[model samples]
Target: MIVLASQSASRKAMLDAAGIAYEAQSSDVDEGAIKRELIGVPGGDVATILAEAKALPVSVGVPGKLVLGGDSLVEVGGRQFDKPVSREQAAEHLRFFSGQRMNLHSAAVLVRDGITVWRHCETARLDVRQLSDSFIDSYLNREWPAVSGCVGVFRIEALGVQLFERIEGSHFTVLGMPLLAVLAALRAQGELEA
Candidate 1:
């Protein structure tokens, strides 16, 4: 059976929509500490490390199971924006992204028997619409709780899409998994039924 080593609803939905059977289990890793520890690493490398870190523990515990872990971050002008920790931070993230194009880096790792079997990183560019103060305020009020950890301060599946002027990337990457790549890896590994 496939085990998703993440608590993300979007990732679960993606698998479900594709008819992939999997169970969601939080890896319970200290993500913030992991990011801090890998601060010196390149952003893409850091994302991959974190993804593997999240999957390794789960893979070790469940022998013979394929465990998938994924991570995403928003980068603007060489700066990484982590999930907003407060309402004010969310508003600020929106403001910083306003009228600017930012890159979203998403990395995924698939582990089996405590070893990484597949890994991939994908990036997407999103041009955020110029946000007015009022709009930012309203958006924060409505989405602060749900969109906190997401890189772009918006959930494309919800009202967050309205904040983007344009997007250049696969839908799955934007949602944080890069579904096609993951599926290809799974198929190649013969983990998913053909």
Candidate 2:
């Protein structure tokens, strides 16, 4: 089993559905500080940095085990977005995103003994359809709080699908991890069957 350095439900579900066994450990990384430090970095690079930050500490603690750290971020019109702190902010974000193309960057890193052994990042493009205020309100009414923990204010596997008119990328990437690449890396490292 590997160590999963996040408490995110979507990550857990992805691993679970893939039959991957992992011990979930919250990385406790200060994300805001990392974002502040990475100001102006591309979204994918920022995600990779965040993923490494999360996994490295856990890898130190686990000593011999592989630690999987994953992170995702949203970029719209050259601005990076974090998880919305409140419903109002989420609504505002949706308004700005209306009919805009959103770049969702998901990244994952594998580390052992505090050394990163593998890393990957994937970007997904989601076209946000024109959203009327009533539609936004209705969507938020059903998805708030739950989606509050999600970047881009979405959980693609859920009602968040309604926000997009078109999506171009791996489904797993949109779900917030480069899961196929991660699984391949695990197999390459003999953590999973070849």
List clashing residue pairs in candidate 2.
none
Poorly placed runs, candidate 2 (over 4 Å): none
Task: Write the residue-wise lDDT of candidate 2 on 113-161 in tens digits.
Answer: 9999999999999999999999999999999889999999988888999
C-alpha lDDT (0 to 100) for residue 190 of candidate 2: 91
Candidate 1, which segments miss by more than 4 Å at Cα?
none
For model 1, the local distance difference test gives: 0.88
Model 1, position 73, has a per-residue lDDT of 80
List per-prediction Cα lDDT, in the order shown: 0.88, 0.95
TM-score of each: 0.95, 0.99
Error of 2 at 88 (Å): 0.3
Highest-lDDT candidate: 2
What pairs collide in candidate 1? none
